[model samples]
Target: MIRFLTYPLVILFLILTAVQVPQVFTNALASWQIYTPLIGGVLGYFVLSIIPFVSRNREHMITFSHEMTHWVFSLLFFRKLYSFQVESDNTGSITHSGGRIGEMFISLSPYCVPLFTVILLLVRHMVSRDYLVGFDVALGVTLGFHIGCFINYTGLYQSDIRNVGIFRSLVFIIGFWLFFAILILLSLKSDMYVACKGIFLRYWDTLVSFWQFVKGLL
Candidate 1:
């Protein structure tokens, strides 16, 4: 069952974080320069989370991106969007009643794409050490944009399909953070690296399918 797999991943994440925390603190003490990337990423996530309370306009812009993510995925899978809407509360959904697989892809695409993109950009900037001054601001902008769209659009928080208990919730959080860490590691490789190329290709295929589907509709 999903629960069985979820708990162990959570436990593993907790163990990893426990092991990493001291190292993170030690590195921070050694040099703020070394720790700026981590700080920037955390700050970025925090700022994006608060956009919902700022203004309707900001929320709507994020909502537009969220829906577009779905639309893109839908077209990638060659699914027709029967209808779609971005509401005033910054919520949006695309209806592809005929394409169950396409709908699933649309739902999952945002989770992988935006999260990975931000992690990649942050890691590249960190390693280059070229934009240390604006790292946090850049991170905040990207994180805010993605997180705002994620919370507004995804069923992760709202749907009843996955009734994650306290332990599971903790595990889910840990898994998400660990995934980000993995993404950072992956981003360190050259663009031609197998792992990097594989991920990009998969997303590209999905995106292309979504685009083609949209074009067909038009």
Candidate 2:
């Protein structure tokens, strides 16, 4: 059942965070740098996707994705959903009830996390670690979908942002995204420890050097 899956999913999330978060902290760029090609494609797709004619028709898709993201987190956290809806004109909402942590994730997910990409990554992870050929294409497209929809929807004021203070919203969204980004990067690489250490030693040294130079100037 869906509820049963939540237990496993939570474990998976924690395991990933344990390895990837510290790795990213030591070397933040490693989390995203390897995805440069795929990210470029995703960004390029975003440019083409935002043309009014292209975007207008896809409004419903965007709206559905937004609500579905909230719905997903709600389900993942075992929250109760009262209702979910998406209109033809790219407008939608989901009503759910849960604890503070779940409430934050359910309300703020649309702006920060890409549910489709996360879902795709999960599907890929479950099926085969190394057998997924051309997985990058699927990953890029869903990532583009997330970026495009995130840009369009977040331009307006949403009730979700108001519920969580703007500062808290950015911190939560960014911190959550960084955690998973590291996980995604680790999965793509053969040497995760090297990647993690790269962040800590190489990047840390560069940062320290930069700081020392700045101090000399002062």
What tens-digit string does per-residue lDDT give for candidate 1 at 1-218? 64466567557555544444454345446665543555576566666556766553676766676667667777888887787899877677777645434343355455434643555464653454566446545654565566655555445564421444545554554445544444433433322144445444544665577689999999
lDDT of 2: 0.66
**How many pairs of residues in model 1 come into backbone collision?**
6
| Error at 5, model 1, angstroms | 15
For candidate 2, lDDT tens digit of each residue in 135-169? 65567777888877766667327778777656556
TM-score of 2: 0.64
lDDT of each: 0.55, 0.66
Best by lDDT: 2
RMSD of 1: 12.8
- Using all chains and alpha carbons, the TM-scores for the candidates as numbered come to 0.48, 0.64
Candidate 2 residues lying further than 4 Å off, grouped into runs, are 1-37, 40-44, 47-54, 98-101, 126-133, 190-218
| Candidate 2, number of clashes | 3
